[model samples]
Target: MPTLQDVAREAGVSKMTVSNVLNGRRDRVSPATIARVMEVVTRLGYVPNASARSLSARRSNIVALAFPSRDAGGVTPMTNPHDSLFLSEVEAQVTQAGLYLMAHSVNSVESTAHSLRSWNVDGAIFLGTRADEVAALHTAYDAPMVFVDNHGTSPHISNVGIEDRLGGQLAGRRLIEAGHRRIGFVGPRFDEPGVVRERHAGFVQALTEAGLSLRPEHVVHCDAGFDHAVAAARRVLAAPQRPTAVFATADIIAAGLLKGFVRAGCPVPDQMSIIGFDDLEVARHVSPEITTLHQDIPGKARAAVEVLLTQLAHWPAARSERRVLGVSLVERESVAPPPAS
Candidate 1:
C-alpha cells in the first residue's frame, strides 16, 4: 500500500508539496514538482484517502437535510408529501455533485443545534422549520445554510419558498368566483409563522375584497393529520350553517376532510366544494380530485441545493439572498359553484 508520504519520498519532495499537487493547488507547487509527484503517484498507484482529503481542506463534503421534531414520536420528515418530493429530488442532486447526504430528525431546537455542531458537514438544508427557530440556528452555527420554505422576514438568510400568500389568494378567488361566499378554511392555527400563516392571510385577503369575512365557527383549526382533519370536517358539516366550500391548507388534511364529507353522505363539488394546497398526488387520487394551488416541489428542491452550492463555491463570502418560486391554481373536479342555499 502506497501512502502520500511514500509518493512524496519517491518524488524527493515534501508531503505538503505532494498534497498541493494532488489537490490541484498548482500555485503552491511548481509545474516540474507537480509532474514529478504525478509520475510517482502513477508509478506507486497511490490513491488519496477521501476522509483525509476532506479533513485537510477543512470540509466534510457532506450535506445534511434536517427536520425539526414535529412531535414526541419522531416521524420521517418526508411524511408530508411536499417534503418527500423534495427529498427524492435533492438526494440525487446532492449525490451527483460528489457529496454525502445525511437526513436527521431533531426534537428540540437545542438538539438540532447540537447535531450541526457535532457533524463537520459543508452546509445544511433545513426542511420546513419555523423561521424563529431557523434564525436561532443561524446565530449558533457559522456553517453555510439553505432553508426550504423559510418565510421569516430576514434579510440575512438564504432560502427557497413558494408564494404562499399568492397561492392562498388564488384558491380563495377561485371559490369566490364560483359563488361560494360561505367558505371555510381548515388547517393548523394561523398564528404560527410559516407557509400556512401566509396562505391563511392571502385567503382572508381575497375574502375581504368580496365583502366576505370568515365566521369564527366556519374556521376549523385542526392538526395537519388524517384522523384529526376527518373529525374536524365532520364537526364542520354537522353545524347548522355548514359552509358550501372549504379550503384546506394541505392536501393530506384535505383528503381526510373529503373522507369525512363522504361518510356524512356529502357529494363533493355538488353539495360541498373543496380546494387544497401543494397539489400532492393524493389530491388527484381522491374520488372527485382536488382543485389546488400548485407549486413546483422539485424546482424548490433544486433551487435550494443550487443556493447552497453557490455559497460553497465562494467560501468566506456568504451571500444572504432568497428565491421565491411561483404558484398557480390548477382547477380540477373538486371545486364547482356552491349548491343553492
Candidate 2:
C-alpha cells in the first residue's frame, strides 16, 4: 500500500498536509493546498492509514448516530418511518462536509456513551433518546452532539426538532372540528420521556381549550410496538363508554385503532373517528386513509446535519440554538361527526 510519506514527497508538501488532505480535515489547510495535496495523492495512488491518521487529528472525520435496537422477545414499537430514509438524507448532507456517517445502537445512556467513546467518533447525533439519557450524554462526552428532540438546551450541545406541542394540539383540534366530543387518547403511556411527553402536552392543551377533558380512563397506554398497540386498541373499544373518536400518538397505533374498530363492527366516521401523528406511508395506504400530523422527516435530517457540521468546523455561533419546524394536518376520510343516538 502507498504511504503518506510517498504522497508528501511527490506533492512537495509536509507529511502532515498529506494526512489532513486524505482524512478530510481541510479546515487548517487552504483550498489551494488541499487541491494540490489531493492531486498529488491521486497521481501517487497513496492509501493513508485510517487509524493512525485519526489518532493524529482529534476528529475521525466520522459522525455517529445512535438509535435503540430491536432485540430479544420484543422491543418498543416505532411509529415514525425507519431511519433508512432519514439516514440517507443525513449522509448526503454530511458528505458534502467530507464526513462519513456511522450508526450505533443505544439501549441506555451508559451504553450509548460507551459506544461513542469506544469508536472515537468526532461527534454524535441522537434520535429517540429520552431527556435523562440526553443529560447523561452531555456529562459523558466533550465532543459535539446534536439531538433531534431538543433534549433541553446547553452550551456544548444543540437540538433540532419540530413544535411537537403544536402538532399534538393540531390533532386534538381536528377531532373537535369534526364535531366529536367524546375523544380518547391512544399513546405509549407518558412514563417514558422525549416525544411522547411533548406530543401529549400539546394534546392536553388543545382539549382543555375546547372544554373537554381527556379522562384518565380514556387515555389508554400501550407498548410502543404495533402488536401491543393493536391489543390495547381492542381493549379500549370494548369498554362500556366506547370513545366516539380516537387520537393516536403514532401512525402505527392509529392503524391498529382503525383495525380494532373495524373488527368490532364499528363504522368509521359513522360510529368512530380517528387521527394519527407522523404521516408515514402506511398512514395513507390504510383503509379509509388516516387523518394525521405530517412531520417533516427530510427537513429534520437536513437541519441535524447542518448543526453537527457547523459544530465540527469550530463555529460556536450555531451551538445551543433550537430550531422548530412546522407540521401540517392531512385530512382524510377517517373523521366525521358523532353518530346519532
Candidate 3:
C-alpha cells in the first residue's frame, strides 16, 4: 500500500503540504497543491494510518455510552423500548460524526472508572444513571461527559432530558378532562430525586388544582420492568376501592398493566383508564392503544451527542449545558370516563 510519503513524492510537494490537505487544513495549502495531492493519492491508492493519526492527536477517536446496570458483572438488558430507541439514535449521530461508539454497562464508580480509563475513551455519555453515581463518576474521571435523563443540579454537569413535570401534568389534565376523579400513579420510587419524582410532583400539582388528591394506597412503587408493573397492576386491582384511572410513568409499565388487567377479565378504558408517558411503539401495539405523553427521544439523543462533542472540542473549558425538551399528549384508546357506580 502507498503511504503519505509516497503520495507527497509523486505529487512533487512536501509531506507537510500533503498532510495539511488530507487533514482538511485548507488554509495551510493552496487549492492547486491540494488538487495535485488528491490526484496522486487516488492514483497511488494511499490510505492514512489511523493509529498514527490517533497517536499524534492523543485521542482514541472513540466515545462511550455508559448504561447503568443492576448487575455489576452482567450485561445491561435492552428490553426497554425507550432505551433501545435512544441507543439507536445516539449510535447514528456518533457514527455520522466519524467517531466510534463503545457501549459499557456501569454498576459502580470504581469499576466503571477502571473500564473507561483502560479503554482510553475520549469522552462518555451516561444513560439513565442515578444522581449519586453520576456525581461519583464525575469526580472519578476527568474526561468530558454528558448525562441523559439525569436530574443533577451541579453546574459542572451537562445533561439532556424532557419536561417530565409537564408531561405528568398533561397526563393528569387529560384524565381529569375525561372525568376521572379517583386516579392512581404507578412508577418507580417517587420519593427518589430524579425524572420520576419530578413527574409525580407535576401530577400532584395538577391534582391539587382540580381539588383532587392522589390517595396513599393508589401510589404503587414498581420498577421500569414489565413483570414488576404487571404485579403492581394486581395490587391495584386488589385495592378496596380501585382507581378509575392510572398514570403510568412509562409505556412499558402501562402495557404490563393492560395485560394484567385484561387477563383478570377487565376491559380497558371502560373499567380502568390508563395513561402512560414516553409514547413508545408499545403503546400502539397493545390490544387497546394507550394514551400517553410523547417526548422526543431522537431529539434527546441528538442533544446529548452535540453537547458531548462540544465538550470534547473545548476540553476543560467547555461550559456545562442542560437541555430540557417539551412533551405533548397523544390521545389513544386507553382513556375514558369512570364506570357508572
RMSD values, in order shown: 5.4, 3.6, 4.2
User: Against the hidden true structure, what lDDT does model 3 obtain?
Assistant: 0.85
Ranking by lDDT: 3, 1, 2
Cα deviation of 341 in candidate 2 (Å)? 2.1
**Colliding residue pairs in candidate 3:** none
Estimate, for each residue in 166-244, the C-alpha lDDT of model 3 and write its tens digit: 9999899889999999999999885547999989998998999999999999998888777887888888888769899
Q: What TM-score, over all chains together, does every model reach?
A: 0.86, 0.85, 0.87
- Best-fitting candidate, measured by lDDT? 3
lDDT by candidate, in order shown: 0.84, 0.78, 0.85
Model 2 per-residue lDDT tens digits across residues 1-341: 66778778888889888777667656688878877877776677776666887887666888998776764326632323646667778878777555688877777788878888888898888887766677788888767888987545454458888878888999899888878777888887566566777888898888999999887778888755567666777777876687899888888888877887887788776898988888888788889899899988889999998778667766434456567789999988889889987
List of clashing residue pairs for candidate 1: none
The model with the greater lDDT, 1 or 2, is 1
Considering TM-score, where higher is better, how would the candidates rank from best to worst? 3, 1, 2
Better of 1 and 3 by TM-score: 3
- Clash number for model 2? 2
Candidate with maximal TM-score: 3
Question: Tens-digit lDDT track for model 1 on 1-341?
Answer: 99988998899999988876665344556668867887888789997886887778777778899876565223345687777889888898886554679998766667877887788788889986787887788777888898988888888889999999999999999999999989999988756689999999999999999999988889888777778878988877976688999999988888889999988899898999999999899999988998998999999999999888778766558777799999989988998899986
As a whole number from 0 to 100, the lDDT of residue 275 in candidate 2 is: 88
Residue 236 lDDT in model 1?
79
